[model samples]
Target: MSSGTAAGRSRSRSRWRAGLGRLAAGTALLTAVALLPWLSGNDPALTVLRARSADQDPSPEQLASVREQLGLDEGPFTHLVHWLGGLPQGDAGTSWVSGEAVLPQVTSAFAVSVTLMLGALVVTVAVAALVSARTLYLGSRRRLHRATGAVGVAVLAALPKFLLASLLATVCGVWLGWFPSSGWEGPASMVLPALALGVPSGAMIGGLLDQSLPAAFNEPWARTWYAYGFAPHHVARHALRRTMAGVLPQLLPTVVALVGGAVAVEKIFNIPGLGRLALDAAIAQDLPTLQTATLALILLGTVAGLLIQVLRRALLGPALRDGALPALHAPAAFRGRSTRWAAVACALALLTLVTAGLLRDPLHVDTAARLVPPSAAHPLGTDALGRDLLARLGHGALRTIGVAVAVTAVCTLTGLLLGMAPQVGAGLTEVMSTMPAVLAGLLTTAVTGPSASGAALAVCLVGWTPYAAQAAALLEQERASGHMLASLSFGAGPGHLLRHHLLPAVLPPVLRNALLRLPTTVLVLASLGFLGLGEQPPTAEWGRLLSENQPYAELAPWTVLCPAGALVLLSVLALSGTDAAAVRSRASVPVRMSRRSRRRGVQGHARPAGSYK
Candidate 1:
């Protein structure tokens, strides 16, 4: 009875700590938002003046007047305090550019975003449920079918949201005229954007459930339920609840990601949401509007996270009490030879493309042959500048792939290190995770101007957060495992345990997670490039290529197709290769474990004979 009380108290304290951490994080982020105008180097007063009247040359008096009106003369702290003070009164200040109240604008935009998010979330749940049901139906009876479905889902998830949005708009909105491609006219308008956002996210959620549900059914409770002659449907329902108890916690990060990802989606769909508002404000250096929009997004994430937590607890209270939660598992490796061979083929194709590109001169301009189609001489054709498409692609691959590899390595190492100290890392990760790469890029661009390096820096800043979160969760799980507890009871030192137990157990999954993130990193980098925040004109980067050639897409289709195809291939390679690599890595784990055990035994025997005796 005392232990139960103690446990309850512990949980209560944990909840308090979590709440305090969130409050602190939100405050710190708002404070940063307040400082953005100052950090931007561009004078907000001048920016506002130009935004209001682009052709007018503002004098010092006008600038000073604008600054005084906007309260920019004060420090960031004052701005933050004022903003906070006004929040209770529903005041969010006035936009410098528009001279309109920020709150109403932000509120309206936020509502639209919320609606879109809810729709996307519904689609996500539906996809996850459908995928999970299909996986279970096939069960052990149709391994091939399950594997193929899983692979298809993975490929679907690997698709960049922008590409998906474009396809949906073209096919459903433009071609079929079933839905409006742009604008928020009615409920029908939301369908395409929701599907574009939800399908990929749903595929991800479905994949996660696909992994966890099988493991849940393998649990002893499931076996007991079967032994008791429970209906199959009834047992499956119970098993799903058990699986979700573990899976739901993982979705918090996904929720944060979904909000962040909406920035691009909103822009593509022409939705008048907070994402679009924020983007426009950022571009215009409209501090008041940008800050309010950013705060709204952060708040949305926090609220969603809270609701998810409440729902999980309410629905899975019995599972929680019974301590029947499963440990988060690494993605299962591909078992089929067909999947492995496909991965290999993709790698070879990519290598050949890169190799062939290296042998050509990407920069040599041939204006005479500009916009040439694929031919014997120019295999992938020439762009408007008459540069060989194949050569640019080859050279661009080096830049894109090199940056991704370097960033992934850094993120992996940083996450592992930070994850080792979860006590200090968790709150920090939470704060950083809420700031998406797009928002980070905007901030970085404000300070350093948009460049490839600034985009890379932006990605690096937020990229580590997901990895760190994963590492922290995995470390926590491992620390609570039976083997880890046994080692602790046997007097294993911290260093020994970390080296032989914790790291070995944690590294595989984290590394695999990083490997899986390669495509995302590439996509993020490309998105920034497409936004003109990455490599500038004359650069042959894939995203830049896409952005530059988009205007001429109908005229010179090859220009767009070449780069788009490259990105798709890379995505496929990363997704398929991760699975193949996991297989090899998992197979080698037992050998590595055996060797470590042998080393430990030898060390035990080699210790000074009876030193204590």
Candidate 2:
């Protein structure tokens, strides 16, 4: 009626349909959250009885009594209904561990996590601004400056949040006596935890700004201001504000990453945040606590997603224009020669650590100096059994990195093969993404009987989805590109196109995808190890170290602290490799802009359409 094209009307209808689909999906997810107690695969009566009996086996008569007393033997819906009824009163349920109200514990933990999150966010934004400002001043033609900045970002981004936390705990708290090692006592205590969590977050946000801000300052309006006798600093100030606007959409991913990274941070710092509570519940298989924690996280993620969407709409106007969403372009890679050197240096350092570890006999035990604190003679201290902590840590790194690399390799291959058929891969990826990594890992461990190989296989099972999805998305874009079409027009066959174009474009993103997935794979492996579902002792897996040394925590705190520090280090080293890869990818490829972006020129908004954080 308003002279809109048919395509525009069709797209509008499609968007509405998509909205409805999302709404239904959200409803189903909420339902699953509410019913998680029933889906935990353990009998409520048995769980309760196990807790009550401690290590003792309860009798059949006792089991029946417990079942009836708890009304678990009643209709399944009855319990869910009762739980739902209590929701209005804010009663989530009782914690199986403490036999106390779940809501209060959750509230207290949530408060702690919120405080940490707020602190991290503040650090992230402030650091991002400063980094961006610094980048603006580093004259555009200076390759050395760019390379230095890239390497710095690569190192920071490469370190896992947990590793950063452990280093802070050790160097600042234990060694330097600058802060308390682990506690939630007061404001001073929060500083180290905040830095541990915030620094890596800031690095990521800063990298985004570093990449976007320079392009923004090169726009025509900024140039016009310069031409009109505006000082370079004033033009840069305006450009920075514009750059912030363009990068606003990236906050969604940052939030998701923050939440995931918090789990390890909370554990290391001994903060009783929601992440720590979730870990406890998972290890204990405390159904009520686990389900409640899961629900809380899901709710938090949902709210964050909603808020991001609202903010995007307000800041960027309608998501779709001319009956289609705007096309997105990858950031152009920085053309610094030193980026490759930085990546090589990272690889060589990690290889050296692993090789040194392998050459040493880490398993040799000296009972004489058991539980020895760190000294010049034996660095990283000795464990309770007097095993060299440094050696075990080195061997552990070898095992952890081996598993991560193997998993990543398999995933990358699978993703590449699957990506060849985008339509098929996309649906399969969606289904796979929905499956829980923990659940899959548990199943795999059960079938294979808990070996390191089984753990790696399990992680691969769930981890491949992300790379696979990214592959499909990237390939689909490549297939639609003008060059690919032009090749087809010249009578290029599928094989020719595959050989000439598709593989080249897809390879870079796939490699970057593998790097991105590394941290998560490490986290999963460690978690499984902690649960006794990963590599057993003598293997020196970091997670197993946590479980094994827990009792020795009071007797020999170093036993626990050392392995944790090693894990953090290994994770950091692994992550830095990814950052280097990203730099290489950005530098090598010609970043193709959408037609819309080209037309808009300097004044046009160059916001990316969408991203999976």
Candidate 3:
């Protein structure tokens, strides 16, 4: 017993050492990377500010002196050393715009951001994990699982964080007058932001559960506990407690990723987290602020990632470590002898697309249209544009789905290559992950001038990075486990390596990403469309659908509700596929045959005699 604690402690220390090494390495890399912008000192932040300041007609001599003082005249390397050394010394350099001490202003602003993220994470993760854990337990009632899962998917699908935050502020802060809106003074100040952040984050938390729970459901020790007449909760305990083995290792990176993340949520909620800080800097093209914020986010995220790795190693020890759990590989519904259900799912998806493309109603709404309302010639109603609202929304649903599928495909491809490839540079993944997706969307919109293609392009660009990171880590597992070498020794060249070995290894995770991300893409499209970044007011995109119907919401609520429902439904459907895939994924992990005797192994499978009862 003493030895076990000692062994666990020893392993814990080993993991800590490893994590610290990664932290140091990651920090050094980030320092070098951040120096690129810091070297320029005044950065884009100062450049833009300087230009604006110049508009006030500062003399050329004054301008030159300003630049020199800001270290803009220094070479990149010199600036790097200054910024790097200065960071630990509480001197992050001066703000280009205000000519204020960058460190103080930045720190003051950043305190709010940190508080908000912590609050949001607590609310989101705690609630989401509990709900998802309930659904994941094999002993969980089927009805409970269904209810928990349905609510989870629906919530995630139906609302973007910004819109949701706005709604909460409108209702709770305004109408109900429960919480204050936009002030940073009291407990109520955090409510709106936390709620706003929590809603979507809960969905993401659910996603983590989506990964963790299914695996726990199928663990053998869990089954043994059940057979031993233990309660379902006890079995779940065994499954999940031990499950850090296979799933936790995979989950750590994502958990880390949640650190310094969720920009839109932060922006909408008025939280002072890194996301909001990055956002404010990015919009103004405040180069110094942007560089500092981004580097800080990356640094924090990297450090979180290292911590998760240590936790996973400590938690998952011998039975499940190094991605060694045996995976149950099942053929897709297409390979079954009947293949009927998979076929149906595909057929339904295709049919939805076809009906969407044609702008036809899926719900037989036209026939039911006159049963409820009356308007100009079209009883179901003309929208703000007087176009057939139902038809337009239906078509928009298709478009939304189409965009989602495209984005998911891109994410999947990126994730697979990165996760399945060993020796691939991690720098690219780091660089991409820190990019603010909303900012990217805003930029794309700013450049392309409001079209579906532009919005789609924006989402595709930002969404791919996270997936790529996930895939890269997964690939790291294969390489660390020597699977790459095994393939190489088996005469698998690069081409064969990818086609047979890598692709297969990465597909399940790719599928998971596809499921999780597709819904997000849909929400993003609708949000952008609502903001008029892509598609015009007349077009029936989901965002536009809601926008057009907002005026009529009081009288003809269904006009808006129906499309929102459809958006939510499609999002849920995509998420459901992900959930189901997770279920199948969970069933694949075999429990260790550790009882150590042949007699016990056979005894494990015996079923109780029911007789005629």
lDDT head-to-head 1 vs 3, winner: 1
* TM-scores of all predicted structures: 0.87, 0.69, 0.69
Cα-lDDT of candidate 3: 0.54
Model 2 pairs whose backbones collide: 158-575, 158-576, 163-568, 253-613, 333-586, 333-587
Model 2, 1-613: lDDT tens per residue? 5566775786577456535544454344445443443555656566666665674677788878866766665644665566667768988777655678888777788778777777787878876666555677753322213423655654555454565677688779888999888889987778888887777667656765675555445444544565567666665665555444335534543554454336667777788888777656654445456556655655565466456545644443332222112112323434455655655665676566566556656788999989899887676678888887777767887667678788889977886786566434523443334334454455566457677787788777656654554455445445544445555665667876675566655665557546644645666677667666678777876666665665576567788776554444444444445455555654443333234224434212232222100
Instruction: Tell me the whole-model lDDT of each prediction, alpha carbons only.
Output: 0.71, 0.59, 0.54
User: How many residue pairs clash in model 2?
Assistant: 6
Question: Pick by TM-score: which candidate is best?
Answer: 1
Kindly list the per-residue Cα lDDT of model 3 for residues 1-613, writing each as its tens digit: 9977886897677556545544554565444444434433334334554445655555667666656766665654675576668888777876656656666666766676667666776777666666566555533322222323543544563565555666677678778898876667867788787767666656664654545454345435444554557666655554454433334433333333343445555554565666666555544545466557656665655555556556755554543344333332222221122222433554585466446435444233344343244354443455544456556655666566767788778766765665444235344444445455555555666567678887787777656655665555444444333334544554556875554444444566557656665656776666566656666655557666665565565556666665565555555565556556744643342221113113333322112221100
TM-score of 3: 0.69
- The segments of candidate 2 whose C-alpha lies over 4 angstroms from its true place after superposition are 1-46, 52-55, 74-108, 130-133, 139-145, 158-190, 208-261, 267-270, 313-338, 369-384, 388-398, 406-520, 542-613
Worst 10 residues of 2 by lDDT: 319-328
> What are the runs in model 1 whose C-alpha is more than 4 Å off?
129-134, 140-146, 211-250, 311-334, 367-371, 416-420, 475-501, 552-557, 588-613
> For every model in order, what is the number of clashing pairs?
0, 6, 10
CA lDDT of 397 in candidate 1?
A: 94
